[model samples]
Target: MASQNDHFASIDIGSHTIRLLVARSNEKLEIYPLRLERRITRLARNFQEGQTLKTPGIRESLRVLEEYAGILKCHGVSDVACGATGVVRKAGNGEEFLAEVRQKTGIAAEILSETSEALLSAKGVLSVIPRTEGYILSFDLGGSSTEFLLLDTRREKPLWHTSVFIGAATITERFLSEDPPPLEAVSRAVEAIQDALAPVFQAIGSILPAPPTPFPLQVVGTAGTATTLAAMNLKMTDYCPSRINGLPLTENWLTATIEHLVRSTLALRREIPGLEAGREDIIPAGALIVREILRGLKQTHLIVSDAGLLEGLLLDLIEKKYGRPQALVSPLTWRMQKG
Candidate 1:
């Protein structure tokens, strides 16, 4: 078991950004955050032409990881867990890049497979809400892929957990070739998103259909896109996780904002407060992902959760070192009411 005062760190190497979360365990075995940092490196830029991470992106990501290593060393944190998502998973040289990371920074990053990613992301959701009843649908929108989780608290595990290739960065790369894409381009993007999600909805099966679920459903959106949308809605000039988390983002607002964003130029988007500066080009695609998700589910609102895969990874390590604390959320055990 780790000492009570020991500090730990978790890193998520994502397609568009690389994030680090440093935390400390208290006397009572509860983990408290020490620092959180994110940097955009567009690790997936021109990724499709060749199924490999670009040299520039690789160098930039390694540079960020090296910086994180220095910080971790300063904090005296030796136990670190890092996970790489879609961009790395799809790239032919993904493992090679990780090898470079280990060699350069001594930080070994595990690539999360699709299903494993779905479950990890869902666990991330539990860290925030901790408990729930009825149906909870959550999606983590990323640069290369988006993962969805449908949890029925009455069951032990999720009703359905799936991943769709449609993502903000990928969609932008595919359809939005023009800056402030033309109407036709936007329409194509919509159609592309719809098509990609069709099969995922089909796989959902009974209980919750693709058309729309009833009153008891609660949709949650996690990760960058969701939090960014919440930040924009709040008119925040900076990224503040507290203000964003648990905040409700309604469908009306999402669709309206997406409309405004798609029509605005990249320069105009960068000027918008709360919308991260590097994200201007991809925000429209991210917003569209959120909008279409709600529209398909007939959900008017979704609660944004800033805590995600990174937190989940840390919590897992914490549990392994010290047995699962009762304070952490239990498995789904919601009882349903029948007419």
Candidate 2:
């Protein structure tokens, strides 16, 4: 079991950002976060064409890794786990980049497969909303890929999970050309999303029958895109995770946001009260993805969750470093622990 004040660290290196989370847990089995940091590196900017990580992206990622390494050492972290997703998994030179990162920063980064990404992401959300029940679908929309999990608390694992490459960065690279994005581009983006969602819907149907009548299905949204939209909907000048957690974003609000973003230029979008500065250009595509997902799932609202891959990684480490005390966790969670 983890002793009091033992620190552990986790890093999630994604296409659009590199995030580091440092947390400490005591014997009570409560984990407290010490530090959370994210840097926009745009690692997957043109990955589709190049098939390798761009030199600029690699350099930027290395710099952040080095900075995070120092912070981890300063905290005297007991164990650290770093994982790369999306761009790295697809990049031809991803292994080379990982090696260089390890050499320069002493952080060995593992590339998580799409399945692992979905699993860990589901685990992450489950850790946060332990009380949620009924049918639940959690989606993590990243820059380069989007992951979905059909969650059932009664089950030891996810009912169904999948990852698709039609993410904000990927869609933006493939479709958006103009600053605000032309109507044609926006329509094309939507069409492409519809096509990509076809297979996803088919897979989801295998586990969940399409109800003839509307039913209670909770749609939980996580990761940057979802959290940012929640922040914007709340008109928060500064992002707060506590406020964002369990936030209910209505479908009407999402539709309005997507329309506004599709019509506004990148410069104008940057001026939006709650939109993150570095995320202005990508918001249109990301927002569109969220809107379409809600529509396809026949959901009226999306519950925003700040806890995701990073939090999931931290929880996994804690479980491994300190075996789960059966008394502290529910039986379902205990079964998940076995996995």
Clashing pairs in 1: 153-334
Q: What TM-score would each prediction reach against the true structure?
A: 0.92, 0.93
Query: What are the lDDT scores of the predictions, listed in order?
Result: 0.81, 0.82
Segments in model 1 whose C-alpha atoms lie over 4 Å from true places: 209-215, 325-339
lDDT of 1 at 286: 90
Candidate with best lDDT: 2
**Model 2, position 29: C-alpha lDDT score:** 65
How well is each residue in 103-214 modelled by candidate 1, as lDDT tens digits?
Answer: 9999989999887777777777777664667788879899989998888877767777877776789989988857879989999899988888877666654657444444
Clashing pairs in 2: none
Candidate 1 — worst ten consecutive residues by lDDT sum? Answer: 330-339
Model 2, position 264: C-alpha lDDT score: 90
Best by TM-score: 2
lDDT of 2 at 201: 78
